[model samples]
Structures are given as C-alpha cells and as structure tokens.
Target chain A: MQLAHHSRAGGSVLVWTMLVMVILSLLAVEVLRAVSGRFQVGVQAATWQEALLGAESGVDLAVVELRKSLYPAPNGAWQDWTTVPGNGVLSHGLTTVPNAGLAGSPMNIEVNVDAPAQLKDPATGWQYYRIRTLGSLPLSGPPRVSYNKEDNRLRKLTLLNQRFIDGLFTSETNDAHAARRIEAIIRPLGSFDQAIMSVGVLDLNNQNIVIDSYDSRDPLKSTNALYPYNDRNADGTLKRQENGNIATNGSILDAGGAHVYGDVSTNSGTATGVANVTGEQRTDFYQDPIPIGAPTWTSINPAPSTVTNNTTLTASATKGAASSRYVLRAIDLSGPQTLTLAGNANGSQTYIEIYVTGDISLTGNAQLTVAPGVSATIYFKGDVDIAGNGLVNTNNQPGDLLFYGIQPDTGQNPYVKLGGNGAITAAVYAPGHDVTVNGGGSDGHVFGSAVGKTVTMTGVTNLHYDEALSSGGLINNYKIVSWFEDTR
Target chain B: MKLQLKKSGGFALSEVMVSTAVFSAVSMGLLMGFTSLERNFTATADFATNHADEMRISDYLALDLRRALSVQAAQNDTTILIPAYYDNAGNPQTPALDGRGGVVYGAIGSSVRVRYYLSGSTIYRQQDSAAPITVAMNVKDFVFNVTDLGKVVTTRITFNPTFMAGGASAAATAATAFYNTTLLRNSRTDIASSVY
Candidate 1:
C-alpha cells in the first residue's frame, strides 16, 4: 500500500509541473503581443503628428505667399496653391517604414487652396479674410495634413483745396477805382487847431492832383463866402488864414482861396485865386510856404512902381505838341505851366511850376538834363512821360534837384522809371505812387518819401535812400545804391 | 496466490497505457497554448517597434517639409526635387524616395532629387557624392501629389509599409503611409508693398 501511494504522488507532481510550464509560456506570448500592439499604436500616433506638422507648414507657406503678394505686387491679387520644389519627397532613411501596414499609398499630395478674402476694404474701413486649406491623404496612401488660415488687413484713406476768395471776383471790380472819387477836407484855425470841412469831387481816372493855398491879406471883406472856413473863436473876431496875406486890422476883404474844377489842362500861365466880392481886403491863396522873395522878377521890361503882395500865380499851361521837339533852358515861372521838353537837345537849368494841368510828353531823344551843382525843381501837375529814349537827369548837386507831385489817391501802384544811363540825386516826394527803376544802364540815388506804396527797382543797378510806407507791394531784382528804410 | 499476481500485473499494464494517453493529450494542449501566447507577444513587440519608427519618420518628414521653399519635378514626373533651407546653413541637401523600384533620388543642380519605381519596395534618398539613405524599407507603394497656386505651393507625400505584425493587420491594411502636405506661400508681397 505504501508503494502504490508513492507512485500516485509522483504522477500528480509531474502533471502539476507540466501545467505550470504551459501557463508560463502563454504569459510570455501575451506580453509579446501587447508590446507589439503598443508599437503599432506608437507608429500611428507618429504619423498623425507628422501630418499635423505638414499642415502647419502649409499654413506658413501661405503666409509667405500672402506677404509677397501684398508687398511686391500691391495691385496683384492673391489666389491658388503652389508646391515648393523638393518639398514633396523625404530624405533617404529619414522616414523609412519597413513592412508598413498600408501599401501603394500616395505620399506626394496636391494641395487645393481657396481664394483669400479681403480683410478690410480701404474705402470702407477694416476688413478680414478667411483662409481654408485641406490636406488630403488617400486611402491606403501616404498621410497628408490639411491647413486653413484666416487673416486681417487694415486700409487707409488720403484732402485736396484750402484758400479764401481764390476765384471770387474779376480784376475790374477791385479797390483801385473806389479810392479816387473820395476826398477829405481839412481846416486850420491856428497853428495846431484843425477841423474837417466839406468834401470835394475828383475824377477817378485823373492824372493830376493839386492842393490849393489859403490867402490872408486884405481886410473889410466878408469871410462867409469862403464856404468851409474854420472859425475857432466864433466870437466874430476874424483871423487871417494860414499861408495867406492880410491887412493891419486883420479884417478880411479878399479872403484868398483856391479852386480846382474838373481836370485842368493848359499851354500857358494864368492866375487863379479866390477874392471877396467887395474887394476891400486883398488876400493871396497858397498851398505851400512861399519863399520871402519867390517869383523874383529878373527880365522885367518896365519895373512896376509898387509890387502888390496880394498878387499870386497858380494856373498852368502846356507848351509844344506831343510830336514837337523843344530844348528847354533855365527859366523862372510866376505861375504853373505844362512844358514838354522834347527834341534831341538837352534841357539845362530849367525851373517850372505845374499846378493842375494836362499830361507832359517828352518825345524824341529829348534830354531833360539838369546840370550838376545847380538847383532845379519840377513840380508835375500831371503824368510825365519820358518815352522815345528821352532822359531826365535830376542829379544837379548833392541835394539840388527835387521832383515833387501830389499823387492821385488811386490804389493802383503806378511806376516811375529812370530809363537811361542817367543818374538822379533828388528827394522825390510822391504821396501815393510807387517808384520803379527799370533799364540796365540806368543808375540813380533817390532820397525820398513815398506814402502808401512800394518802391520797386527792377533791372536797375543802383538806388539810394528809398523808403516805402505801405503794403501790397514788392521790391525785386535790383541793386541798391545806398541804404534805405521801409516802414510798413 | 498465483492467480492474484497475474491479475495485478495485467491491471498495471492497462494503467500505464491509460496514463501515457492522458499525458500525451495534456502535453499537446499546453504546447498549443504556449505557441499561441508566443505569437501574440511577437505581434505586440512588432507593432510597438513599427509604431515608434513610423512616429519618428513622420516627424522627420514634417520638419524637413516645413523648410521647403520650392519644388521641381522631372520631365517624366516620376522623380521630384525639393529645395529647402535648414537652420543657418541656408542650403542643405535633402533627398527622398518615391517608393518606386527605380533609381529615384540624387542632387541635381540646386535641388534634391527623389526617384523610385511605382512598384518599388524601398524609397531611396540620394545626394551628390553621398551614399543613398533608404527612407522607407519594405514599402509596398508610394505616391506624391503637388498643387500649384500662382504664388503659393503645396506638396503632399504618401507611403505604405509592407510588414504588418499584429492581428491589427486589418487596421494596418487600411492605414495610410505617413504623408506630409506643405504649402509654400510667396514671400514677395510684404517687400513689394513697402515704399522704402
């Protein structure tokens, strides 16, 4: 019985051993299978990751393309998908899949791209665009990643005119015509006391202007007929007007006043002054201060026995035709005249007074030449024309010759020309006109005062002591002979 | 006594026969189980390894393709070339196989060339004077598709492996080879718009 029990136990032990071996083997195989499955999973995940990266790469490419198009070809449109050369294929041994699961799969892929939408309309404002990309991997083919993108761009816009009255009015309706018709009157009571009287009428296109002198000499004349008289005392105590002759009692008889009617033109001299109807007191009318011995009579045939202080000269006359040539010499005038200095001869030592008169034309090769070291004054009542190569040399001494004129109050800045190779050294006073020096050969030094106008020197080599006291003018293209002051 | 001895001996023989038959059946059953387990383990290992390799390959492909600037193809359309910039090196040689059985990769001019037969088993990548690097071995097939936009480029690559390790052969069979599709956008637009 013991022997039999031992054999059975041994047999049982052997069977147990065999069963354990089989279990161990099965466990090993299962572990190996699990490992293999994990490997396959890993490979799949890798492939998906690669595809994703590829998709990102595609998006980057699109960005680059968009940038290129927007900058290089601003006017060109952006569309379509493009392949980068050598990008489709992989490097040797870099991505080798031995015994891969899929067979005959297409590794190379074509990308279809949608049109890029505008992000912002420049005319409207901000805009945006949607970009979509698809990376298609065929069944049993190489994997591919599809890419999509959306972007935005900002747009900007650019005013053209900014001036007042650029095209408002024509040249004829400008301010030049309005100034000539208006005149202001001033009355003097004493040395400092002054008042405004009645205004006067003047031609808008008048070439000449004149200021009349007041007379105070005679007595026993009624002062009421003087029109706008300044009676400061108003106590019936009459005083003689400034720049006038009066008697000892200071009672006015002939209250001397001047009148300017229409536009005065003349060929000879005439006396024009205001007188009282009774003629008890005689007075002389004067605008400027008369010298103590002015109008000195030199060539008198028969000297008058007693010179009357009340007698005065203020009228003007014209000499010679516009076409005639005349040589002017030194002469004295007790009154005004319009002397035309024409001809091929030179004018020397000539003195003339022009109150209110017509135009003075200097035709031909006339030279209104004032000799040096001599004094001369030409007071023009009208426009002075120095045409046809005519020359006016005002340089007589350091400060000898003077050209004085009352410029019409027109707003137009009329020009005065020294046209030849002549030099002028004078204090020219034109209260309302601009002085222009034109001509290449002309040179002069002008020391003068011009109110309310510009002194332009064009094509001139030299000018001296020139002053302008207003605006709306320019001084250009000329050489200044000496220092000048401009008060504006 | 003699009768008892003869009977016992005969019974012993029968017992031995029965035990042998039983042992043989048990052994066969254990052997079959172990064999099945071994096969499963092997399949798992293969799958894990192949998956890792696939991941590595896919990553490499994506990175290289990302650097692609342009693409060129041979006249026959079987060979493709890719020009790419790598790091600060500016230009680097990178050739890939098309999975065909032909000579499909080399460096030509300034581009990397890739060539393979449509029925090739391995994808070969070659550069000038450089030994070819096999990108995908035991590959069943490979294909490439390239798309063109006027200013942009897209390249797609697909490949299949030959060996399938696990019962996941069905999944493997349906599985597509790793592929990278890249779009190369034009870089001139930004520069063109800059006035300076």
Candidate 2:
C-alpha cells in the first residue's frame, strides 16, 4: 500500500508542473509578439517617409523635363518623356525601385503634368500647368503593367492617364504608408502679370495719364486688340477691365490726380496723392524675382551684330520657326542713324532676339522702327537712352517689342531713360535700373507694361497694359504658382 | 492496538523529503518565469511609447521647416528656433503685411517666433512669449542641427528605457536614436530655378 501511494504522489506532481509550464509559455509568446509588432511599426514609418521624399524628387525631375522641352518647336522638345495623345498637353515620367530612394529598397516615384493650358473660348495664348506626382514605398500591392514583369504581383502603379481620380483633397496624404500623390500648378513670373511693377517708388507725376488695360487676344475688347477702349463700365471708365494695375515694393508718391483705371498697390508704406485713382489701393504685395541673368548668345544660334547704318532684318520663316539673334557690343545711334525691323503680315511673322553688351543710346533723329508682324526682344546690359526720333513700333502692338535690362552682379546703378517720342509703344523690365520716362510733358501716351527698380513718369503719360501679355510674353522664368498634396 | 495503527499510517522520512524537494523546485521555476514575462511586457511597452514620440517629433518639425522662411539653432541641444509662421487653430499662417505695412514679428494673428526647448524630460514649443505647449516626455537625448543657411535641418532624439537589470549590457539599456535630415523646400538652392 505504501509503495502505491508514493507513485501516485509523483503522478499528481507531473500534472501540476505541466499546467504551470503551458501558462508561462503563452505569456512569453505574447510578449515576443508585442515586441515584434512595435519593431515593424518603426520600419513602416521610415519607409513611408522615404516614399514621400522620393515623390518630391520625382516632381523635380518632371519640372526639369518640362523645361528641357517647353513645348512649341524652337524653344525645346519632349524627348525621353511620354507625351499623352489627343492633344500633346500632358507628359508622364516614371522612376522604378531600381532608382534608390532616400532609403534603399522597394520604392518608386512617378510624375505627370497637364501642361500649357489654353483658354476655353479659343482666343489665343497658353500658360500655367498642373502637375501630379506619386511616391510609393514597399510597393507590394497590386501589380502594374509598366512595372517589372519578373516581380509580377509585387508592385503597383498608383496613378496613371492624368487621372488620380481621388484628387483635390486636403494635405491629409492618402499614399504615405504605401503610396502618396501630390499636385501643383506652375506658371511664369513675367512682367505682364501687372501693368507697372517697380522695386522702388512708382511716381506718376502726370494728371492726364490714362492707365488702363486692353487684351490684344480678345476682339471684343479692342479694334483688333489696338485699344480704343471698346468696353465701357457703369463707373464711366474705358475698358473698365481694371487690369491696368500697378505695384511697388516701396511706396507710391505724388500720383497727382491720375486717372488710373486699375488697382494701385504700395507694399512698403503709404500711397500719397492717389485720391483720383479708380481702384483699390493696397499695401500688401510681395516682390517678384526679376534677377534673370544675361542671354548666352554664343551658345544659342550666335550671329554677330555688325550693322552701323540703316538696317532691316526680315522675318526668318514664320511664327514658331527658329528666330534669328544678334549680339552687339553696343547700339549707339547719334544724328540720323536708323535701325529698321520688318516682319511678314502673311502669317509668316519675323522674330528677332538682340543682346546689347554696352549702352543703347539713340539721339537726334536716330530711330529704331519695328513693322507689323515683327516681334523683337532686346536684353541690354548697360544704360538705355532713347531721345531724338526715339523707338517706334509701326505694328502699334506692345507684344511686338520688348526691352529687358540686365544688372551685373556688382556695378554702379544703371538707368533706362525714354525721352524720345518714338520710344512710346513697348514693354520695359529692368530689375535694378532706374527706369525714367522723361516724357517732357508732351502727349505721354504710352502702351504696355514697365517693371524697374524705380519708375518715374514726369510728363503727361497714358500707359495702356496689354492683357494678352499676361498669357504669353516676356517669360523670364517659370514658378510653382500653386501647389498641393492631394489628400483625397 | 491504537499505537500499531498510527505507526502503519505514517510514511518513510526519505519519501517525505523527496516530495518536498520536487515541489520546491517547481515553485521556484514558476516564479522566475512569471517575473520574466512581466519584465518583457513592461520593456516592450516603454519602447513602443518612445517610438511613438519619435514619429511625432519628426512630423511636427519637418512640416514646420518645410514652410518656414528660416530656422536657427545654437547647438546640438534640445532647443531649436523655427521659421516665422504663426499657429492658427493647428494650421500654420503665412507671413503677411500688418496694418503698419511691414513684416513685423509677433503681430497678432500674424507671423510669430516659434521655438522648441526642453524642460527636464519634457519638450515644449513656445510661440513668441506665449505659454509653452508640451510636445514630448522622458527624452534622454536630443540634437537639433541647422546647416546650409537654414535650408537643411537634421534632428536626433532618444528616449530613456524604463527598466534596466543589474549587469545588463550597454546596448540592452540603450534605446533607439531616431535621426532625420530634411531640406527647406521654400529656400533650398539645389533645385532648378532658371533655365538660362
């Protein structure tokens, strides 16, 4: 009986020991699982961040492509990128996982652009583009057709065909964990965004000045976009489109009862004597980046400028064809020397680009004439003084002639003065020069826009802003006008 | 007769001793296993909390730097000066002209100075002279480095482990160091700006 009892006690002990071991093992497994899960969470966060960075890089690459091939013939091409069919307005580019992201693995970046939008009413001109990009990490979702065939069921293309359908959402990022998409609109910061923009004070000393706007592309606004003020507003104003606005980073002084038919803005301080102006006078304006470098004509279709007497440059081919360029050290015409420019009215317009390294002084009957169908732009490095017969645009279109001033990295303050009667119809941009229109109090009737470091009109001037310039003219550089991450 | 019955019922001394020894060993083993389970659970929970803090710090700092016009930090300490942007209902308000027509800092509902500094183990984000808002807790180490003229910001943050056993290795007690380097998209110069 004693031997039997001893064996039975050991048997019960074994059962108790087994129960304790099973419970302990379960707890240990739970702890291990929790630790593993946390570790994975950390990894997931890092991968998502890398995906975001990659997407940003991808968008930048797309911008480079757009610049490389800026649509329309002679300026650039759309070579390596895929141009969407139906209207060559869209382009797409992709970077696969082989291209290392911020972290090295399973990440892909993609970018697409809906570029150079046109007006729906079919007037003319094109600008402004929308871009969408995707950044993906550990892209082991559904497979995509463009992805690697060997990794069939591992990665997916998040967006395609210009429709990230769930677009226009908050920045609440839809694709950060595995995929993300962002969208941005781009445009150029040209002089045409406003009528008159100056880095310093904008002094309008003339009371008879008619600062108004007209759209050259819109027929309903003018007689073939020539500006007789076809539209009238209830406020008894001409072409009350009110787009003949003016802005300055400094202050506006001595407006002197000017009939400004547009908005006035002085971002720095106050706007004095602007009581007769016919628009809102605001003081909250941001400065534009007009720091564009000089043109490198040596590298781009170089042609020496050797004309000293009366000269005429005919149209090369037509619009969109390669425009001829001439780089001259200086353009100094004194007493009877004339420079004539002619274009074709038969849809084959002439386009010319001129770079003047030194001063451009025209005095005593010295004339620079630009005929119809001629579009010319002058990027000058030194002072520009137009007296005597001055500069004349027979086309009477502001878009036909453009003057952009180039400031050196370090030099004395330069000047762009227009005291000649012929230097009336044009657009002028000199970010660092004092652009003074010494009209001598004559019929200060001027056309187009002016952007300078300081703009002063001493005479009775009527400056008209061509609204068409806002759509296409004098584009120095492109910028992201609006950007957002489509959280949707 | 009674004495004989009692003697028969009693067990041998060796038998009792062997049973005592086995039970004592089993109890000791069970106790040690439970202690280990509790320790692991607590350690893992603390580690996860630290990781959550890392993610939070990165998100806030990166967003602020990307939109800020400038950033400043004195050293690799738990302090950093952010860009000129004001907080409006959890949103960053951009720089704008005040009624005085100039960009002055700390104007009401306008651009304000945002600074992040440490207080003991707690991190606070101070906007102007306003009351500081707590951001993180139990941070053991922090580094805020600004380079490339406020265009590049690098940050490293570490949290202290809650429990450390005796004779534990240095690595076992050391928590993860979360590091990140971000660029100011608004001011970075490496991007392509002008074509020619």
Candidate 3:
C-alpha cells in the first residue's frame, strides 16, 4: 500500500509539473504573437506614410512646370509649348524616366489658354494668351493606391492689334474741378489723321469748358457715334452747332443746354448753348463758303494809303466802315501768298475781313489791329503760314476772328501756323486740319477762342485765357501723349 | 510486537507533523515569491505601456502645437482658435495660437476650442470643441514652455509608476511608480501668440 501510494503521488506530481510547463510555453507563444503583431502594424504605418509623400512630390513637379511656361523670355517673342516636338517634352530639363510599373506610360499635359483674340495678327496668326495647364500623372501603382489630381492658375498678357487707335488728350490745368467739368468731343470723318484730328486747349481753369460733339455717348455702337466721349472716330470732323449740339442720329445737345447750328465753342467762362437735332445732319454747311459771284481783288496796286514800315497798323486804321473794311488782296505771290501792310492807321469799331482765295502767308513783323467793338474775319482758301514777330490783336472786349477755308470741303489737310512772340487777344475759329502755336516765349499768352478740327502744339506755346475756350477734337502735346495707350 | 508497532506509529506521526510543517513553510515562501514577482512584472508592463502611450500622444500634440500659424478669436474673445496649424495640404485646424499668459499657457476657449495650461505638476487640457480627454492624470509635473522666438516648444512631463502595483489607486500608483520626466521639443517658432 505504501509503495503504491508513493508511485501514485509521484505520478500526480509529474503530471502537475507537465501542466505548468505547457502553460508557460503557451504564454510565451502568446507574448511572441503580440510583439510580432505590433511590429507588423508599425511597418504598415510607415509604408503608407511613404506613399503619401510620393504623391506630394508629384504635385510639386506640376507647379514648377506651370511657372516656367508663363514667364516671358529675354526675347520679344513668348515661349510656345503647344507643338512640343518629341514626346511633348518642354526642353527645360523637366523629365521623368518610367519606372518598372509605370514604364512607357505616356503622361500627356494639356494647357488651355484664354485671352484676347484681337491681339493675334490675321496675317501672321501671332497672339498673346493666358494659359491654364492640367497635368496628368498616370501611374501603375497597386490597385489600392490612387494617384490622379487637378489644379488651376491665372495669368495676364498683352498682344498687338492692327486696328488700334493711337491718340492722346492732355489737360492744361491741375484743377480736379476743371478736369471734371471740361469735356472734349472729337468726331472724325474719312481717314483718321492724328495730325489733323487733335485739338489742344491750353487755358483750362476752374470754369473752363470743352464740348466734344464728335464723341458718341454709346460705347457699343460701332457707327460713327460709338464711344462718343472715349474714342476718336475716323471722320476727322467734330461738329458742335451754335447752341452746343452734336448731330448724330438726331440732334444731341450739350450739357449746358445750348443750340449750335454748326460746331460752336466759347471761352472757359462763356455760357454757350446748343440746338438739338436728329439723324445725320446735312454736311453741306461744311462745304467751301466762297460764292462764285463775289468780286475778286486783283491787287492792292495803288498800295492802300501806305505809311512808314515802323508805324503799327492800329495807329493808321480809319474809323469808318468803308476804310476799315478795305481788302489788301494779292493776285499771285508764292504757294504761300503774302500781303505786306505798312501804315499808321486806326478805324472805328468795325469789321475787317481778309479773304484769301488761295494759301495765305504773312511775313516780317506785321502788326494788324482792330479797334474796340471791332470784329475781323480772315478767310483763306488754303493753309495759313504766319512767321516772324507778327501781332494780330482784336481790341474789343468780345472781339472775334473767323477763318474760313475753301476747297478740301471735307475738313482735312487745312493748316494754321503762328510763330514768334506774337500776341493776339481775339477769338479765332477754324473748322478743318490743325492750328499750331509755335516759337512764343514762355512769358507770352495767346488769348483766343481757337476752334480747329485738330490743334497741336509744335513748340513752347502759352495760351492765356481772359474768358473761355473750346475745341471739337483731340488736343495733343506730342511729348507726353504715348503713355495712355491700353496695352492689354 | 505491540510495543514496536506503537513506537513506529509515534515516529510516523512525528514525521507527518514535521513534513507538514516543512511543506507549509516552503509553500508559503514559494507563494510569496511568485506573488511578488507577478506584481513587479505587472507593474513594469503597465508602467511601460502607460509611458509609451503618453509619449506618443505628447509627440502628436507637440507636433500640432509647433506648426501653429495664427490664432483667431471668436466674437466674445473668450473662445479662440489656438495652435491653428495647417496640414501638409494646407487644411487649417484649430488652436491657431499658442503661448503663455501670466501663469497660464493657453488661449481663450470657445464652444469648439481648447486651451492647454499647467498648474503645479498637473497639466490640464481643456477643450470646448469636444469633451476634454484627461490625457494624463496623477502627473507629478507637467510644463509647456516656449523659447527661441516662440519657435521652439518644449514640454516636460513627470510621472510615477510604482504606485500602480497590486491594483493601487491612481494617486498612490502615480506617487510610487518609476518617476520619469519626458522632454518633448518641436520647432515651430513662427507661430504667433494666442491673443484671444
């Protein structure tokens, strides 16, 4: 019984030892499994992070390519990437070799450009454009991985167009109030001659007024009336009737409520009005005003009451209407006809009309003066070229001079030149071509109402205003006019 | 024969008593050693896991705090976007601003905003955006400080793990656990201070 008991007890002890060992082994296996599982999780997390970084790299590459294509080169021409020669690769060192999985997978990038079509020359087909690029990065990664994306960008550019209008208008004053109140209306007919279509009004003040009859109030209308206030039309004739009205489809009145049968202008302070009309008005008024039955003065052969050359013209002019209205006409001189006046004469407030059947030229220091309450009208069939220190003065408070031209009835190619330190306190009006005030020193002022189809300042010209002035077209002082072109 | 049998019986009884006493003593010693070892092992494992988790969360939060860009305040100025950091893809997250004001190193909290502050050795993280996660309790010392033009954000957290042995209370465990202070530093000095 003792031996049997000993054996049984030993066997039970052995079984208990075996059970402890098995339990220990199982626990070790479980611990090993847990550790391995955790390590595997760490590896998986790292791999995903790497994949995300790779995707980010692709985005960076696309941005670089976009910036490169948009920037201009040193040359005038812009870079073109549309017709990429081989494999559509832009030769700026941006390239990628195909990997094993994504090898030979052609990645095509397309750039959509939107810009002004007018910039492209119809003949050369060269144009400026703003480009938006979309690059596709095709990949052969695992099915679980996604690798496609899109981005957008914007750029601005300029191009050349054949139908661009190059013209400028400069204000002679710094007053914001004056600039806001003064309006220039320019109407051009036929070909647009920059030289003949500009009007310069120098004495701009707080109350200065410039009425532009040619400028169209509507911008969308492509007819002559389009862009009334903003652009110059091709006709070259800007008309403002007596009351300050522009004749378009009908009579377009000025802001001052004036009626103008033809183009009308006044000094800065003049309260002028215009008459309204509708539809295109008759262009007949602009025709040559020379009547066929008018008597022609062959010559001042007897030399009308001539005096010493030094005597100023104002001292000798007769006060009567017959003497004051004497015509010193010339038959033939040069292409520029000259009439030399030498006398000491004065006249009552009368009208002095100088009619030139052809181009008129005035030389030497000729002084012509009209007495108080007097008005003079100089008519020339051709251009008027005045040189030397010539003085043409109207002594009356509201004295005026109207220069009418014949031939070229279309209001083109007419020219007026004023040179030297000449002083003229008179209202001068012209309809066609241009008026140039040149050679006057900085101190002198030309006080007048100058209405020209286009007025340009050739040299240093000072315009002094005792009253008001207006113009029908553009006023350009050549040196500073180029900056206003819209390059976009 | 009877006398011999009686003497053997006494010897047998004495042997039984002696064996029982020895067995009892040995079993008690072995049991005590096993219990002690088990407690130590469990304490080590729990301390390791807790420390690791704390370090991981600290690192994650430190990264977010370092990359903070701007702090924006709500209408009341009581709540603000603190440590507002943008992700790699430029997606903005809250906590736009960070820094210390007086003894508190945090910004204002809104309904969906949070502020981090330190009091003594305990670090409290409060969020109005969501229910606050205690994050770490029984901390011996916790500090979030800035330096280097507000670019460097350094955090130090100290805790005790030995107190956790034998199912101890958090306070007790924290007091007795292995005391370790971890310093987590991140570079995001451009982050503006919280103005909220």
lDDT (CA) per prediction: 0.30, 0.62, 0.34
lDDT of 1 by residue, A131-197 (tens): 2222212222222111100000000000011111222112112211100000000011111000000
Q: How accurate is candidate 2 locally (lDDT)?
A: 0.62
Tens digit per residue, CA lDDT, model 3, A261-282? 2232322222223333222223
Docking class of 1: incorrect
Error of 2 at A298 (Å): 4.6
Candidate 2: misplaced stretches above 4 Å? A1-128, A133-182, A206-208, A230-240, A251-256, A298-307, A318-323, A344-348, A440-442, A477-488, B1-196
Candidate 2 pairs with clashing backbones: A69-A77, A175-A179, A175-A180, A391-A422, A391-A423, A444-A461
Model 3: residues >4 Å from true position, as ranges?
A1-10, A22-488, B1-18, B70-114, B117-130, B133-149, B163-196
Rank all candidate structures by their lDDT, best first, as comma-separated numbers: 2, 3, 1
Restricting to chain A, the TM-score for each candidate equals: 0.23, 0.64, 0.30
TM-score of 3: 0.29
Instruction: Determine which window of 10 residues in candidate 1 chain A has minimal summed lDDT.
Output: A149-158
Tally clashes: model 3.
79
- Taking all chains together, each candidate's TM-score versus the true structure is 0.26, 0.49, 0.29
* Ten-residue stretch with the least lDDT total in model 2 chain A: A146-155
Two-way DockQ contest, 2 vs 3, winner: 2
DockQ of each: 0.02, 0.03, 0.01
